[model samples]
Target: MSLPTKTRQWILASHPTGLPTYGTRTDTFALETHDLPALSANQILVQTLYLSNDPAQRGWISPPSQIDPKRLYVPPVQLGHAMRARGLGRVLASQNGNFAAGDLVQATLNWVEYAVLDAGDPAAGVRKASELPGGLSVTHYLGALGGTGLTAWYGLVEVVGCRSGERVVVSGAAGATGSMVVQIAKGVVGASYVVGIAGSEEKCRWVESLGADKCLNYKSATFEADLKEACGDGVDVYFDNVGGQILDHMLANMKQHGRIAACGAITSYNGEAVLPMKNYFDVVSMRLQIKGFIVLDFMAKAAETVGKLVGAVQEGKIRVGEENETVVQTAFEEIPGTWLRLFEGGNQGKLVTKL
Candidate 1:
């Protein structure tokens, strides 16, 4: 099959200030007739369909000088670089025996309309390229059945070791990973209470709809009180997506031997001064364990984890609720402005760039 002669991509324009600003942090590059390099023996060309915009993508490009030394995450995006992102795409051309044209695949295809990569590219492995299940939208493969779902499964099951009858709390409850954590903890483990903290009342309600026993709006003035009242039993596990204050609060209320999974810290991503947690004493007194985890660490187990999650979805044991709001950009020119919308708290659920 012939590779497409041109591709459109979003490129990094400048470093961000505080949280990411779309136009400032990103720019779009258009290649009307760029030639595709000849594919190597184990390579394929992909046509991107859905690109994920995650909060972690924000931290990936945060300036080193601004980031805290103790908790530095991914490095900043280099200027003039094609922005890094996870995308689901269809194989348009293939030189590898493992994949072929028309095969649907997922890869780190970035925010672009097309990409060519070797099957062995660390970011371009093909997990499932064909035989998409009936009744499942391809987009779910990028969300519930993809990275978001895997992250939740790994963090809750592996890192936090959530158990039946324990109380679990998730920060960033309305977001993708947070929402999945609530459902998996409650549905799979039968947690006594699954509580979620989201940014708004609507998001709190959405979290509750996902089987969370209680959901609190962190944006409220009485958030701490609400959180305390919601978790009648002290939290046994905290799946922290937004760290900083929510973590500090959870730390204060953690039960003896409680486990905390430190996922992405969206709360502290904007470079605002994070207040020190006054509850370090609790960690020692209660013998609580707080461990940081990167989903990349569990890539080896992704297949096993994804199989279970896909089965759950297929069996109707868990619901993959769609937050179908899409922020469409005109052509490839608007990506930079679109990307920045994330830092301002302007997006909900998964942000996918439709190229």
Candidate 2:
């Protein structure tokens, strides 16, 4: 018996404005469903169950030559190309003896319902779908247990090298990656003090619930003073997700020899004008060690990191949360607009599109 094939996909139609807009540059591609082609010796076919929507995906669509030199992380998505995404799926057919049909897997598939992948393909890096441990959700594999989780872990543990009894500050504290950074710094490293900055009072409270010793709303009039007061002991490790002004303020408060992990700069993602840092002299005076990295650079340790995180979650040592929104059938056309919502501070957690 052969399985039927037909699929709908999202494709890039044109470059986006400062923010993605509806009816501007996104289109749906209806692909003819054909019989599952015989896979090569190392190929597998998967049916996507969940599609991940990440900030980095936005950067991927920007013209390669036009993106800021510092922000180039992955190859640009060519116009008319299938939008790239990471997804959780179950194998429906396999040519590789290592993976059998019905095996749950995760891979970087296009934003479509089904994908044909080659296990030996360097880009795919297919792995068995992680089993959800007690009190953990499968979706977490795409968020806390997956890429976002790894981003937080590597930035703190590897880049920032957070130490016990150190004072730490994290920007974008209410976000999926930032939330995990707070918990990992406080619960895992047992930091002496942990401060979080977010965009809303409700998000500030949410950050506090995750063990941040202090939480401040970046949108508040007194945000800078409040942040300074919260970290009076001095910041030893600054995990920055939103750069620009928040980074400038935090740099002013860093103690000598402090380390900063420069993560995503969502603050500048939507801006038409670049914000200049007038206080870079702080890096020189404080002898700060500032490092920037992408999560893909740490893929070699993903399995080990996932194991540790799973252990932490199972022992009640660390808490995890997720914010998700469903893209309605008609709303498929609204993806570009929906993507822009992230830059406007409209999303609370990991955003995903369900097919």
Let me know the TM-score candidate 2 reaches against the reference structure: 0.89
Who wins the lDDT comparison?
A: 2
Tens-digit lDDT track of model 1 for 288-324: 9999888888989888888898778777666864462
- The 10 consecutive residues of candidate 2 with the worst lDDT sum are 24-33
Please give the RMSD to the true structure for each candidate, in Å. 3.0, 3.0
Clashing pairs in 1: 22-336, 22-340, 61-76
Tens-place lDDT digits, model 2, residues 132-229: 87645577778888999899999999888899999999998878789899999999988989999999998888889889988999889988889888
Deviation (Å) of 309 in candidate 2: 0.7
TM-score of each: 0.89, 0.89
Superposed model 2: Cα runs more than 4 Å off = 22-38, 68-71, 321-338
Tell me the whole-model lDDT of each prediction, alpha carbons only. Answer: 0.76, 0.78
